[model samples]
Every structure is written in structure tokens, then in C-alpha cells.
Target: MLNIKNLQVGLEEEDKQILKGVDLNIGEGEVHAIMGPNGSGKSTMSYVLAGKGGYEVTGGTATLNEVDLLEMEPEERAAAGLFLAFQYPVEIPGVGNMTFLRTAVNAQRKARGEDDLSAGEFLKVVRAKAKALKIDADMLKRPVNVGFSGGEKKRNEILQMAMLEPKMCVLDETDSGLDVDAMKLVAEGVNALRDGKRSFLVITHYQRLLDHIKPDVVHIMADGKIIKSGGPELALEVENNGYADLLAEVA
Candidate 1:
């Protein structure tokens, strides 16, 4: 579960605020979607939770299962079971995908005082997870996200998520640059990870993605704050009416 209260963030390099007061709670096993127009601080919130730099927390707090997220390093956050899938997954030109994954997995395990997976164990598990995502062996041998299409990159991200088995997941515009089929594939990978104990916060602009991954609750964020929340029908309403009506009502 995740709890954020009046979370405020501003650009580290400038004098501008991104998240004014984002207060939201996601219970265990619940899927929540955040839909908002551009520059509404949707992605900013994700970055802040992931502990990415260049964003200073000006106010409020965020916690994961009662642990203060704002106080931890990015790697510490990951070790604490927080996974973030970026809209645009960056390429590590020379790092092999498998190498990156194994290292990360082992690092997290070490951080948690768990034993590292042997090479065989890691290979077995990763191959199984990769096959489900349709990630080929050649792709895994290549550098992370290097030469991969948009869908491939997103699928790789899901594979990372599946491998990590994080407690809370924040997907920032995972639907971006993905076609319908790619979206479904990615969504399927995400859905497979849902086990009634993991929480998800999906940030997106379109309803097509939501159609694939149904959210238990849908929130509308504007002006850096979550302005409205409802059942899955809220996404349908946004699709039908757009955020104009919601923004107007909130104003």
C-alpha cells in the first residue's frame, strides 16, 4: 500500500512547482489510474516517488507500507519494493540486459539480506518471465533498450517489474508510443503480476490502456493535485467528456 499526503514538489534547478499537493492512497492489491492533461504533474509525481533527482520536496510526505519514501535513496526505494516503469525507458548503451537485471536483482536481494540467485536459478526464472513477455534471447543478450522498438522497451520494463516483484508499482504513461497490440501485451504482462497484494498507480492519457488494465479506482489530476476520484467508470467518463468538464467542475 502507498500513502501520499499533500505532497508538494518543485524543480530543483528552477523556481517552479510541479506537484502542489498530491494526496492519494492505494490499498493493497488495488489498481489506481491517474488521468490528466499535459503539464499536470502526473509524471512528476512518479519521479518523485521513485526518488529521481532534480525535484525537491517542498512539502508533504509519501510512504510505502509505512516507510518514508522521501528519506530513502532511489536504490533504497527499489529495495523497499517500489518499481517505476518510465514512459521513455533510457538506453544503457553498453550494459547487457541480462547483466543489468541479474546485478539489480542480486543487489536488491543483498540489500534485503536475502541470498543471491545462482546463475542457473537466475537464468531459469528470467527465461520463463521473458518468454511470457515475448522477449527473445537475442534481445536479452543485447544492451538494455538498445535497438529495441518502443514496445520492446516497454515489455522489457514489464519483465523487470515481473522479476523484481515490487510491492508498489508506478507506471508513468506506459502506453506512450505503444500501438494497440503492444499495449495489450504490456498490459498482459502487468496483469500477470497482480496478486491481490501489489498496488499499482497507472498514469496515462488515453482510455485504451485502461481498457486492457482495468483500474479499481480512477483519479483525475489537475494543477498538480488529484482533483477527483471514482470507480472505473470515471475513466469512461473522462474518455467520453475529456478533462475539460472535470477541470471546470473543480475550478
Candidate 2:
């Protein structure tokens, strides 16, 4: 469902490139995990895919269902069914969670030329998803991520994913800072969203989260490129033996 070819990206003013000839493909109904150490450019890949600012696509192309994804704006990308769940969720002090979600959902809907959701209907659907994701109603009424625990923030991210129902989803270190219970909850949310028409690229450091949300393919990234790609066993190997062994082969 998604294709990234020889992707090279860097900051707007800097000559140094962060992503060097990166290539990846994610198909429908498949889950892919990307594991790497710090400064490996995994997050940069996510940001570039999502069309965030300050990053210039120096080379390569990314396509979604045969459409040029890199040509679209961030909001346009969302309308094209691309979702990225951030590793760090920013708290909006005054913006209520539900309000923010409604605006986002409606904006996407409007962009797609669909009718805006009524207040009652929007609440019903979002509430159902929140409940399934184990997110409380009061949390929805509160400001987005305001004073929320690490687990709560992660759950909120998953809840947004569930509500958005994107064609492609990227989870950037969703397992970070989460405890055992929160990790399970976050993984379950991902599992429940799994379907034949959707795809996911889950970026994580450890293999723990992969235990719950088993991926069809696992990739090891170093520097700016994906060096090794394999099955679920690859994640276990990384967990047990660490990336040192794999890095040697790739380097």
C-alpha cells in the first residue's frame, strides 16, 4: 500500500543528509516493525512520510496506492489516509481532547468532500473507540494529554488512530516510557485496529511490544538506511543478542 524508494531527506538549510538511500514497502493487511538505536533516522523517516516541516526531500519518492505522497501537504496526507502516532504527545493546555479530535476528524472529512459529522454522531463514534481503547470519557473532556500519565498519553494516541481509520499508520516509539500494563493496552489497541485493508509501520526500540502485536516483517535500521529485513524471529534476536551483532553485518 505504500512504497518508499531511495528516499533521502535532510534539513532545509543543512547540507548534511539524515536519510541516505532508504527504501521500504508496506503492503495492505501487513504489520512491519522497524527497530534501531538512537540517531538512526527512524523518526526522520516518519516525519518525512508525514510531510512535516524543516525536512527537504533531497531525493527518492514515496507513494501511497500509486499516488505521490511526498507531493501532498501534511493535512493533505491525512486526507489521503496517512496517520502518524508520535512518540511524544504534546499536551494542549486549553484544548479539550474531544474538541480537538472533532475538529481533526471533520477537517479530514471536509477535505474528502464528505459531510461533517453531527455532534451527537461524532461523540457516539469517538466514545465507542475510546471505550474500546480503554480511554475514559473524562479524559476526552479534559485538555489533550494535559497532566496525563505516560500510559494515558499513549492510549490517547491509539484512540486517535482508531478513530481516524487511516490506510497507513506509523507508530513512532509508541512503546517508549510505557509500563507493562500500558504497553499491553497500547498493543491491544493496535491489534484491534488490524484489518485486511489497513497497514502499519511500528517503530520501536525493544522487541517487547512486538510480542503482543506480532509483525509480518521486521527491519533493522542503522545510520539512515534499513540494513536488515526478516521475520518475527529477528526481533527476538535483537532483544537477546542486541543490535551490535546485526550492526556489524550491516556496517
Candidate 3:
């Protein structure tokens, strides 16, 4: 569903490259995870794919279902069915969560030429989705991510994902700062969206999250490129040993 070829990205201002010759293909209905150490460009790839600014595409192409994602605006990418859940979800203190979600959902729908959900419809759907993520009414009534614990913020992001129902999802370290129970809840929310058609690219630093999510393919990225890829066992290997052996082999 997502195809990235020789993806090369560099900072827009500086003379430095973050992603160099990264290529990956994720078929529809598949879950793929990228595990790497800090500064390995895992998060950078996520931002680039989402059409975030400050990163210039020096080379390569990224497409969603064959649509050129690199050429589209961030909102256009979203309307085209691309969703990014940030590692640190920003808190919009003044805006209500309902307002933020409905506005976003409406914007996406409007961009897609679909009718926006009515207040009643949105309330019904969001309440259902929020409940599934274990989000309480009080939490939803508050400003987005404002005063929420780390787990709450992450869960709020998942709720956003569940509402949007994008074709491709890129989660940047959804496991970060989450406790065991919080992680499980977030995973459940993510797993609920895996319907054999929607695809996921999960970027993380550790393998424990894979235990719940169970990626179909696990990729090891180092120094801005994928060094090795294997099945779930690859993650197990990294967990048991480390990236040391793999990096040495590649060296």
C-alpha cells in the first residue's frame, strides 16, 4: 500500500542528510516495524512521509496507493488517507478535544468530497471510539492532550487515528512513555483498526511493543538506511542481543 524507493531526505536549512537511500514496501493489510537506536532516522522517515516541513526531499519517491505523497500538502496527504500519530502529541490547550477531532475529521471528509458527520453522528461515533481506547468523558471534554498523562496523550492520539480511519498509518513511537497497561490499551486501539486493508508502519526503539502489535516484517535501520530485515525473530534477536551483531555484520 505504501512504496518508498531510495528515499533520501536532508534538512532544508543545513548541509546534512537524515535519510539516505531508504527503500521499503508495505503491502496492504500488513504491519511493519522499524527498530533502531537514536538518530537512526526512524522518526525522520515518519515526518518526511507525512509531508512535514524542514526536510527537503533530496532524492527518491514516496507514494500511498500510487499517489505521490511527496508532492502533496500535509492536509492533502491526510485527505488522501495518510495519518501520522506523533511521538509527542502536542497539547492544544484552548481547543476542546471534540472540537479538534470533529474539525479534523470534517476537514478530511471535506477534502475527500465526503459529507461531514453531523454533531449527533460525530458524538455517537467518537464516544464509541474513545470508549474503546479507555478514554473517559472528562478527558475528551478537556483540551487536546492538556493536563493528560503521557498515556492519556498517546491514547488520545489513537482515538484520533480510530476516528480518521486512514488507509495508511505511521505511528512514531506510540510506545514511548507508556506503562505496561497503557501500552496494551494503545495497542488494542491500534489492533482494532487492522482490518486486512489498512496498513501500518510502526517506528520504535525497542521490541517489546512488537509483542502486542506483531509486525509482519521487522526492519533494522541504522545510519539512515535499512541494514537488515527479517520476520518477528529479527526483533527477538535484537531484544536478546542487540543491534551490535547486526551492525557488525553489515560493516
After superposition on all C-alphas, the RMSD of every candidate to the true structure, in Å, is 0.5, 1.0, 0.7
**Model 1 misses residue 206 by how many Å?**
0.7
Q: After aligning candidate 2 to the native by TM-score, how far in Å is the CA of 37 from where it should be?
A: 1.3
| Candidate number that wins on lDDT, 2 or 3 | 3
Which pairs clash in model 2? Answer: none
Per-residue lDDT for 105 in model 2? 92
Error of 1 at 52 (Å): 0.5
Ranking under TM-score, best-scoring first? 1, 3, 2
Q: Judged by lDDT against the true structure, how good is candidate 2?
A: 0.94
lDDT of 3 by residue, 1-251 (tens): 99999999999999999999999999999999999888999999999999889999999999999999999999999999999999999988899999999999999999988999999999999999999998999998999899999999999999999999999999999999999999999999999999999999999888999999989999999999999999999999999889899999999
**lDDT pick, better of 1 and 2:** 1
lDDT tens digits, residues 1-251, model 2? Answer: 99999999988988878999898999998999999989999999999999989998999999999999999999999999999999999999999999999999999999989999999999999989999878888999999999999889999999998888899999999999999988998999999999777999999999999999999999999999999999999999999999999999866
lDDT of each: 0.96, 0.94, 0.95
Best-matching candidate per lDDT: 1
In candidate 2, stretches whose alpha carbon ends up further than 4 angstroms from where it belongs are none
* Residues forming the 10-long window of minimal summed lDDT in candidate 2: 127-136
lDDT of 3: 0.95
- Candidate 3 regions exceeding 4 Å error are none
lDDT at 223, model 1: 89
lDDT of 3 at 143: 94
* TM-score per candidate: 0.99, 0.98, 0.99
